[model samples]
Target: MAGARFITLFVILSSACKVNSQSSLLEQFVSADTTNRAARFAYLKKVSPTDTICLNDIKRAIRDSSGDSALFVFNVDGFSTMLRYENELAQICKSNQLKFKLDIGTDIGYVDQTTGCYQDYLDLILFEKYGKNFKPDLHKEANDLYLANHLLDTISSWDCDIRPRCLSANTHTSISIVVDLPIKAHRKEWVVDKKPMFAVYHPFMDLSVVIDKDGNTSGYQLVDFIPARRQNKKYKEQLLAIAIQEIKNKYYKWKPAEINGVLLNTTHVMRLEFEAAAISK
Candidate 1:
């Protein structure tokens, strides 16, 4: 009777070991997503052994399935806009009894511009499921489509007048100011050197001007000065002084900016480009 009891005990122990081994295999294959690295590791460690069985089975089914036959689940908040599409996908999976992978924290508000359909978005979700096994041609096609749509959107919304124009003869000569705001300057031309080597020079100055609520000009500061050509350092200083003085002599009658019916002070940076051609012959 003792020997018979010993053999039964051995059988029970072996069976228990086999079950434990299978549970470990399931745990190894199961994937989980959490808020952060530390949380994910902790969750993985705390997962119940029974849960591994279902997770492992899903992983196996996804691996063995072909094409769209594979199923997946996106673990997102039910209130999310993505729920509508995910629910439809889930139903399809149910019909096939195909186990699916989990997608965590997916944004579903994204819609296609051309087709206005979710089919393209669904394709992306499926591609993500395949991971490294996804076809390169399909991935490239998706990227190309995205770029083409982006280009179209950019072209449609582009406003030429709002774009920054570099200081050039065509743009600088035709300065556009607000109707009430007129800029006045004392002298547009400056003599760089008055000695044996006399040269007439024109330089570009970038100035920051501030207008108060009363339409009065308040602050004036030189942001930058670019000389038409390289000259002596002392000569450049004189040119800058002349430019600042000219800007100071100028006056602006601004229409004050208002917010909620109250006038507000505003600041603007203006680039003044002076050309030698503008000088009297």
Candidate 2:
């Protein structure tokens, strides 16, 4: 009788353990949305008010998540307004040497065929004026853009080598920020756009993007953002130095991994530094 009771207890305990494991995985994969209201609310309470755009509201309705990282996924609407604010953010991350990934949507939103810029305001005009009968062709164009940019993997594959020996890894290490910018698509304006022109172009910033020991996506965090200038170049050097110092200090057991049976102890640090002029557009 005692043996039977022991077996029954073991079965119950195992079942509970399995449930707990599954719950944890769900939490990891789940997007930041209302379905996880309790967790989302708790997270917002912890964010600093100083973070340029207050993410408190969006936290409740996020469709994507960056694990425990407090990510802010801005769309074209927010991108327009955040232009002034984003530079500051880039500076902070650069100063702190924080490893982050910047994900940008490749194609989406209202695009101008002539200027290669998306006239995002057109959407508002169409909705207010023509309602559903508004330009279906334009709507289709925007839908196509969204579908093109929705693929997350493509954005994560950029080789942003602004600094020397930076971003030399194959694993996933990224931070994504989507912005809506007008692409100059007018035939007259087309002459001005350089190579690989788009009706609407999204800027992506990848900071400290590197692979992990387990052959998975992992990167170090650079502070937040730094100023955009010659001085920022020095800041990149300093940030990289600090990151290397920290890795040596903590995560002691973390050893460099071999890629293709070849060990690459490359002292490469991922960095993001760009001109305010380039990003402002």
Clashing pairs in 1: 71-100, 72-101
Full-model lDDT, candidate 2: 0.30
Instruction: For candidate 2, write residues 1-39 as lDDT tens digits.
Output: 112212322333233223113222112212111122333
- Give the alpha-carbon lDDT of every model: 0.36, 0.30
Tens-digit lDDT track of model 1 for 1-281: 11221232233323322311322211211211111223322333343445443234344434545464644433332222122123333444555454444433322222211110111223334455665223233323333343333332221101111222222224334332221112222233445566343444445677666655555554666788665555423344554555555545554555544322334455556666554323232
Instruction: Compute each candidate's TM-score over C-alphas.
Output: 0.28, 0.19
Give candidate 2 regions above 4 Å deviation: 1-125, 132-144, 147-207, 210-242, 245-281
Superposed by TM-score, candidate 1 places the C-alpha of residue 200 at a distance from the truth, in angstroms, of 14
Q: What lDDT score is found at residue 97 in candidate 2?
A: 43
